[model samples]
Target: MQFYCSKAAAEALETTQKGKVKSWLEAAPVPEAAGPWAWQVHAIKLARQNVFIVMERETRFAMVFWGIKKGDGETLLKQFYERMVNLLLCMNQDVNWLNAADADVAIEQILQRNKRYCFVAGVDRSVQTHINEVARFCEGEVHEIGSLLMDADEAAGFDEAMNDTLRSVRGGDYFYPNAVFFCSWARQYAGASDELCLELEARFQRVRHERMAMRVAKHSDSSIPVYEQIMAVLQGKGLKP
Candidate 1:
């Protein structure tokens, strides 16, 4: 199935902060790195069901929604995109770079090749090593959902913590008081992914011994049992509480 944007959808898209996405992407000094609006999509089997994970790479915020009927991959993908775009619009974000893997036919429908492509934006809790890892939330895949949350209750808790985290993010907090929440969200949703890092997941190769080098290293110190360093980093820059 092809992805279509109706007139209403296009008109509605124009009304969003997604335009900031376009504006930001063009003005961004580092185009090669993931933009503030970049996102990643993955379809995985979990709880004996198909789950769609759409994650904003920079923000590291994710929304999990169920998508059944795995027979038509394209159809499922299209549905995922539709919901994701709606969610993005709600959050006042849009996509500049979208990363996925090994699905050429499904991926091509959304690429506009320097045109006004619409997408903008879109996890979690752990039961935490550090905010250091949540600080680097973009370096993993979403398909390892099974390994992270385990079951429905944990997943539900994930959504709750994530909703709270989103509230903090929307409040324009560079570093929130409850920074530990970010670590919990990251550990379950973004950490411990099976896929190799880098946005080019299509060419993502799992190198031997690559498993040892984790994207998120647990932080600790003799002074503190574990460092929730996000606030410390901000305080260093004179972010007054």
Candidate 2:
């Protein structure tokens, strides 16, 4: 998530909005971190129905893109992701041209693009019997983008997501990776087939949506039941309602 800007970019940004531009640049993620990083991209409505979110899962840092037109699958994500990465490194309006980098796009070269940086294919979570969230821009094929972007564009939603991300990374949220939920489920289902394990994951997500509908007044990490469902399934018990 560390960023580096050219001397010119820094100089130009320093003057804009009395350093608001520079501060925003300093605060946003540049996406070059070596990562087992998680990402999710999907569309939402704003000034248009075409808004898309680009986010890093662990950091919960996000960017929103708008006025998109659907294109071929990989073409759509790569084009936008390339733009998103470049936008992060440069000023808001224009891309920086760095003679120092060996390639025309340093981060794209660094990330190795589809080989590692972006997901060209879709997982199409839309098929789940629960809710259908098609990445409408990806030609109805879907990838596992997030539920967060619907709310995260706002400061309150952004802070809440960032807080939950930090807490989850530190193992506070039971349903987060490496936390008690996943760890316990992994322990119980160590030898299970991949499909079976994925089913458990799906059920957890379903329960999460149901819980989110009943948003709590003192919101924090989702409570224990979401975690419990996975364990119950792995232990050969039926899923809980």
Candidate 3:
């Protein structure tokens, strides 16, 4: 139910025409006030463009729209309504006019004729399912690599304590431990040939460094220090940082 805007988003909201972005935030439904399937919106900005992320925690559902403009909140809201209608239709639920009659009528007419419908909730659920399956497989793979590392003569320095630390450390909170595990994993299990794994490791390092640079650039320009505050709130809620 808590709302937290990213630093870039906060800055954009502040600088945007008055009542533009504020109206969008006001229009977004609070989680506590919404239905089980309703979205909780989070604002963010990337490359000077506004973004609104909609999520439903119970279903692990999410949808994102970027590069939003002033006075476009209604457009996004209509889109969300359309998406939900399409989803309900897909599930063979009886179609009824949505509360936003004008918006729903137009969307309903469009959907009535269209045979193909892509629902955000459906897509998000599918993706999350796939991710969970892949994660389970990858965890097994990582465990194999870890075992190899522990048994190898060259891995003498990486003892049980070090391995425990690597596994337990929260990757989202600290970058260095993540980098360490990534490099080790890439080197040990990425490819059959040592040269291939080494090449993959180099590429990973380059990508990681570039992303870090970009993060620094984005966060440094914002005055509010929004990310830290948001993280603190999330941690307080017993969510991952």
The lDDT leader among the candidates is: 3
- Please provide, for model 1 over 113-208, each residue's C-alpha lDDT reduced to its tens digit, 9 standing for 90 to 100: 212323322212320112223322312323444344434445444443453342234335543212222332223333413332222121211220
For candidate 3, the TM-score is: 0.29
lDDT of 3 by residue, 48-116 (tens): 445555444333234444456633655555655554444333212111212345434544543443332
- lDDT for residue 224 in candidate 3, whole number 0-100: 45
| Whole-model lDDT, model 1 | 0.33
Q: What is each predicted model's overall lDDT from 0 to 1?
A: 0.33, 0.36, 0.38
Clashing pairs in 1: 62-123, 94-120, 95-119, 95-120
TM-score of each prediction: 0.28, 0.29, 0.29
Please give the lDDT score at residue 165 for candidate 3. Answer: 24
RMSD of each: 19.6, 17.5, 22.5
**Model 2 lDDT per residue over 111-200, tens place:** 553343323222223211111122242223223343323331342233223222222233344342212223222333233355655654
